[model samples]
Target: MTSADARDAGDAEAFPTVQLDLPVPTNVRVRTAEFVKSSVEISQCPKEGPPEFAVIGRSNVGKSSLINMLTGRKALAQVSKEPGKTQCINHFIINDSWYLVDMPGYGYAKRSKDQRREFDAFTKAYFKQRGTLAMVLLLVDGSIPPQPADLDYAAWLASAGVPFSIVFTKADKKKKGGPRALSNVAAFKRALLEARGFPLVPPSVVTSAATGDGKSELLAFVASLRGMWEAAKKRR
Candidate 1:
């Protein structure tokens, strides 16, 4: 059977529930500021005491929109009509205590083979090498059925041993009880089924940049991870 077919038939019980309290990303508590992008500095992302939550997803998957939603700002990550606009890692200091990293999206574009290759190399390096990345929120398009490329990338992350979770974007665009959302999440599970040594897999959260869904759950998750890291550093 094809991998996707097998996945579509797999049991849901095998996937454990990740506890999360969904919260809206509101402007009242969101004090966001965008910082400059420096690939060199990105290498040292975790050097500081604050924990970093990095967001990565496919090109034009409303990544910038999500960031703006989370920060309660109109245009924090620079929304653009073109794909592959975010060529570098963008950092935002939040509440002067933590950071939100805006990573370049993967898959699809009209770029030449060389540019695509360069992007692949750069993004792979960032995920494999970034030090202070406490949590990586990989955004998924909840408005459509699962794409093969998304599954492949999820498996890649599993194999690479990177910590990450699924964040479904643009849920407002999806019809309630839609097949698209189910397919997208099912695809994610299938990819993760092959992951080794990645115990305690994180939970997937649904969000809408327009409605600000899942904002609280995401922040709480990040805050929890930050605490764990802090405790570990203290022990060292």
Candidate 2:
């Protein structure tokens, strides 16, 4: 296995694997998805242009697959079964109008601990500095209960004034138990509210890359905010 494979980590056994349970819509189809460039710092990012919506998660959260599934571009973002292959801020132009930013997966990466820390340093700067970032898709593994890292990241986003939505990935995988993903999702909400005292439990959707679940809901969310970031430019 590659270093990426070896480094990919996931929390095992949270609840029953969630089923294909979320309602799906058909509108807001992606007309085109094209990878533009990758950047190490916010300075390297594309000029303050189309609104950018980012996707971020733990290394093994099925983030690449979820992005591919969401855009209906089977190969849009590089898919790695291992964790930490993506080490840059990847920009994908969506419909030539907006950008779908695929951030390096957090919590795990193939890089050395110091390198991972360095990665986080720059990305955090990007989040704080990028004026065109419209939203962040906080991809989470739906099969597990609340993870401390996930909760903390969500809290950080809120504290930083970043608009984000939790997009639960892997809704199709199921293990033997009572309620599947729904239990984990609910537990996550409770933990965020109770443990983090996060007052506003942000919008969330259950999704499965395997079954293309929650694709339209996510796309609809993205569509709803495509050009809204233009206001960010004027404030800068």
Best by TM-score: 2
Every candidate's CA RMSD:
6.2, 8.7
lDDT per residue (tens digit) for residues 1-236 in model 2: 53322222121132223232222333367788899999987878899878888888888798778778878888888888778878899998877888888888887845789988888787778888887788788988877777899998989988998878889888777622353233576677767777887765777777899998888777876665552444445687
Deviation from native of the Cα of residue 25 in model 1, angstroms: 15
TM-score of 1: 0.78
Q: Estimate each model's TM-score.
A: 0.78, 0.82
Clash-forming residue pairs, model 1: 23-216, 46-132
Error of 1 at 213 (Å): 1.4
User: Which residue window of length 10 is worst by lDDT in model 2?
Assistant: 3-12
Give candidate 1 misplaced runs (Cα > 4 Å). 1-14, 17-29, 38-49, 175-183, 190-201
lDDT (Cα, tens digit) per residue for candidate 1, span 57-97 = 89888888888888788877888879887777777888776
